[model samples]
Target: MKPICFLLLSTSAVFAADAPKPKPKPEFQYQTEGIQVSLPRADEPKVKAFGPETIKAAAKYLDDGAICWVREKTCVNCHTTGPYLSERPALARQLGMPLEEVLADFVKTVPAEVKPQKETEKDGIKYYGGSWTSIWRSIGLAEWDKHVTGKLSAHTERSLQEMLMRQSADGSFVSYGEVEIPHITTDFELTLQAARAVTAAPAWLSSLKDPELLARVEKMKAWLRNAPPKNDFDRILRLQLAYYMPELVPQPQRDAALSLLSSKQHADGGWCLRDMSALNDWHFKMSDTVVKLISGLPDAASPESDAYMTSFAIVLMRQNNVPVSDERIQRGLAWLKREQRVSGRWWMQSLYRGNYSYITYIATAQAMKALALCDELH
Candidate 1:
């Protein structure tokens, strides 16, 4: 009887060991318009040929994606709708796309109160939902006013005012701190976007009459001038800031930032986010197993050219006076043109914990912006 019991237990253990494991949950799952929707997994398909029709398909994809996000989430996010507003306005007038609806959606995000109540705290800092939203709304509205209407709307002013109200005493704004890379991760990126917002609207800044608002702007400028960049990502942001607000970044520093960015371009004429900073530098808190599972590729320790970085690098270089005729700019643009997926979106692997890769949305937006700046999208 004892031998039979031992043999049965051993058989059970062997069966358990051989059982197939359950699959992991997808990184992104949500409902859109009363229907369950899961974002497609990120992948790099073979490049499609670029032509006039390519731009049209890309435009349709951008418009559909932005409107869908706004209707479903009804909130400003760093990944998709925010970047769509920031970059799409420039192309809308040229492409004859309808942007008023999307623009209105962003303006509605601004709170009516001058100083909204903080809703949460992270690492000892107070955070408001509007902290991140206001800055992005300001940027989006500023872009719309600059490129589309050529006049700042009252809502744009209100959004900027709300953004200013959320500013930290040190001249930076609080970020989501969700560890979402490239944006919503750090105070520096938020501050840089705030700078871009205000500088992009010179008329709004000059028209400011409120003494408190003026002082807040001064504090922000001082912080921008004093805050040191922690990595190459920050440096590229600084180069972008110099384009809009030259006073915050010295000419020599601006030149050095550009040189550093130029040096990081891959042989394929693209840039890799991994090359911008070490994994530790990003300050993520996920475990190794989770990282490997979500990334589902080679470790991020090695550099691989991606759409977000490539389009971002090209846009910043052009903004800072790099000519489209330059070989580096040409190659980078060529890479972008070659990499458009069949869905008309440029694919970028998300550096965040999820597989949503909504970063691809921004990547596509920036890709279009880069092409427009190079006179390829007209």
Candidate 2:
């Protein structure tokens, strides 16, 4: 009887040890009122990424921006807004909304969803910045297709074709809004934006198969080869164009660019920003009134490690096959995670404008992607 009682107690202890512990409630960045995310997944995949803390932080940051952006109608800048556009649907799904319905809500905000509100430029281009809109609209369509009908809308087709035509004989497109030239930071950032538009709209491109479009793409790729990158930012964008459009950048150039970027990684495990003069020259070539109005930011720049650029560099490195477990990546992720403000924004200066709202939005959006993508990697 004593032996049997001891054995029974041991069995009970084993069972209790196997019981699951309760998970901590998600610490969202804002009140749990308007937008929310599902409880963190407790599966193998989530663990394989970062632990729950990092993901919850990301959810909070994204949700905080969703309402503000839609109401202000400022989530429209393609360069600053593009990553957020691509990331929103995934966020919607995580919040347990019917993916299709939530995505439909987002589609309503895209430029092509309604008619262009402004008149044609002197160039007879109704969307002087229409090319950038095409990029954003197509990115929306791409994200939407993953969860919905997967069919390209009629407006999307027409919009894409028109956007494609907006490209110039020199294989460049007008960045249009806020920027007067391609050298917003990198001489080729705007050009890379043009390539990114086509690369992102896979469903549209796959369906159309226009030979003329193909030739134009080849021209764009070749143009990149001929056009040298102006700075560190340019160098990375050129590398990314290669990553997205392999046929565009030759193997040697890709290898060289990657080497250059890898070598530039700081000892602290993140990348730094370029000199002030690089951006200040063309960027601050602004109206006196507007310049005076911009406050809480600088007219010059600094050589410092920036979250936005570091995240960007991390993505570029990872896309080129650097593992998430790599020390450089781990440090980069650590740098980004530590830098997040309690309010959920990452600190970074402006290349185009000194508007803190725009600066924080763009940097935080890009950093979120870097962390999320790194987390995705096994």
Candidate 3:
């Protein structure tokens, strides 16, 4: 009887361990554009139909968020308004939407003169004031100039020059020292975005006659050429840089990078952020259990392929001249078209510490851009 009781007890323990955990309740929720948006979860409703109407809906969603951020926050944020301005102008051009308010707001952030500012310490690391803000503003304004205005504005050029003032002695722009994955986290990633900003504007680099500004540009280019990417995110940024500055990334290196990124695409034709870089690599302060809970991936080793990474991968591939007819590109496009949420936004769980998965804002923006590049927005 005793031996039989012991076996039963052990079997019960095993069953308990294998039981599925309940889905995590959202820490917070709010209404945006009259739709209730909870913190990003894996179970958001997928749209049943996707077409021109859906594209227009997405444009409205993006426009509302960007204009609201500009009016209310009145700040340049990497996850929300920053990515919106960088990507949405192109979509706005296609959809005939208004972006004047947001563009004006960005121009306002550029200062008349670049001056030294005090550094603030967070988590024992000192970050220069306005460094992060300047970098994002440069990228956003440059993209607005490239896609919407067709000529660089004086304000855009001023923003770029101010960004150079924040450049570190090593030629890389310093970040906020927080662990916000795929956005503001590393010096290398920030440097690449700065490079993108400089190159995106038509003939901006060639137009530079100031020896000091030209020297700074050469310094940044040298860092880009010599600085090795620390992770897959950095690698992706480097691949993007290759498009604008081919000499930075040699042909063999570019092919290798492309192959590495292509290999990570899941069977469902999407890319998982976790698969691209380990959670530990991002240095999340939370435990694995808590991170998994918030990400809604309790049983799996990693989160599923998400809209942000999928759209990002698609855009990167397209920039490298991968045609819409390619199998990988087609599959990725299908996944993006099928995954639109009912709110006309693409839901992506934040890789940062907070409950507000604002990364979804950028995800939605990137998704629209990906579709446009593939000629799916018509």
TM-scores of all candidate predictions against the true structure: 0.86, 0.68, 0.85
- lDDT for every model? 0.77, 0.56, 0.78
TM-score, model 1 to reference? 0.86
At residue 305, candidate 2 shows an lDDT of 70
lDDT, candidate 2, 11-109, per-residue tens: 768788679966654453223346532321112121223435555655555555554444444444443335555655434434323224324444554
Model 3 spans > 4 angstroms off? 1-41, 116-127, 283-300
* Tens-place lDDT digits, model 1, residues 1-378: 555655656777878867997668654333456444345455646446887777887787677777777777788877777888888877875677456778878877766766644556666766565677778888988988888888988888888888887888788777654566777655677888998898676399888899988999999889878887767787778888888778778888888988899899999989887688755555434446435643566654565898888988888989988898999899999898888977677877767755566777778888888898899976
Cα lDDT tens digits, model 3, 58-98, are 78777777766776578998887888878876676588845
Q: Ranking by lDDT, best first?
A: 3, 1, 2
In lDDT terms, how accurate is model 1? 0.77
Top lDDT hit: 3
Q: How many clashes does the backbone of model 1 have? A: 0
Instruction: Itemize residue pairs with steric clashes in candidate 1.
Output: none
Winner on TM-score between 2 and 3 is: 3
Clash totals for all candidate models: 0, 1, 0
Candidate 1 vs candidate 3: which has greater TM-score? Answer: 1
**All models, RMSD in angstroms:** 5.0, 18.0, 8.5
Model 1 is weakest, by summed lDDT over 10 consecutive residues, at 28-37
